[model samples]
Target: MSASTPHRPVRADAERNVARILEAAKVVLAEDPTASLERIADEAGLARATVHRRFASRKALLEALVAQLNEQYLRALHEAKVDSAPPLIALHRVTELVMEIKFSHRLVMDVVTAGTPARWSYLSAEVRERAELLFARLHASGAITAAHPSWCLKIYLAILDEVHHLPAGAPELASCADEVTARTTLQVTTVLGALGGAPLPH
Candidate 1:
């Protein structure tokens, strides 16, 4: 067989542009999944031709967003130190981290989850495994007593799914830092309570 060509590294400016486009796409598409490439280009402050040259089509751009979401979830899990932190602390940290991502990328998440379910299923399975392991730790630590680890994990994930369905652009919730903090606090409390854990102090 002939040798396969090695992929070239992206130039720094090109890499920066890609990052810019992806961030802009997240913001714009979260507000409107039907947003156009020109709209995204405007949001990114780049030439329309630049975005078209980078993504080629809306479907191609959504694919890139899905890939970005996958990396982000993995990073969040790593940063949460789910494997090492105390179970309650780890649970609180991961829930908060995931909430930030899901809130910012709601519509993009909905579109991709509906159109490309398999992409998220792969990530979900890994996240589920890690989360269930955390729940097992919680159970061992006596934070959860009434349910199995798998069951607790299901409840936690369900809460996250429900949070994803909340209003992404509601000004009262979006613009107020206290509201966001309260929402996350409620989410953690609900998960802990539903999983039979004592609530952490505010």
Candidate 2:
């Protein structure tokens, strides 16, 4: 076998290692955005040398983490089927999924913003479409008398932002079924009230 051929597998293995490190970086940094590379390496079960070889500096690591955050978030939006459910159900389910995502991925909630990388813009557009579908359904059913769809969309998103805020630190709601249930109730109740939608059956 050619000597060059053997080196190919080594490179492939190195790439896989980098991916693992970045995923671990997501978890570590979400809990503490300033976490050290050594801590991240520990999270990845990798040597510091392996992580440094992939990311030369903290800035490089953070940039990679942002990209990873956007990718995972967009994927979660797809998995949530934000546009496929009935109007009210879509609002509740999408809110639930987004809460789960925000709670699970601290990096995503921390880094995603108005000026996030251009590639992530489509995710926001899809979310707005979800809002439009929901409000449209409410209008059709005579459930809301919102005269301006744009205003209603703004209110919907604003409520979502407040409900999912993580001011102290990244959320730890992933494992608590009772907390998720309570938050889901709060989310549905507040958003529905804000949008003038009728109360759903308990």
- Tens-place lDDT per residue, model 2, 1-202, is 6868979989999989989987787787778767888999999999999899989987777677656655655565566554565556655666676677667764545543423453334344545555566677766666666756667767766666666663432363333445555566677777678777777655
What candidate 1 gets wrong by more than 4 Å, as runs, is 1-10, 47-49, 106-109, 116-125, 146-151, 163-177
- lDDT (0 to 1) per candidate: 0.76, 0.67
Per-residue C-alpha lDDT of model 1 across residues 84-165, encoded as one tens digit per residue: 9987888788877888887667656776666764434635567667777888888888887855777786677677676555
Off by over 4 Å in 2: 1-15, 36-39, 47-60, 63-76, 106-108, 111-143, 147-153, 165-177
Q: Which residue pairs clash within candidate 2? A: none
Model 1 has how many clashing residue pairs?
0
How does each model score on TM-score?
0.71, 0.63
Return the clash pairs for model 1, or none: none
Q: Pick the candidate with the highest lDDT.
A: 1
Best model per TM-score: 1
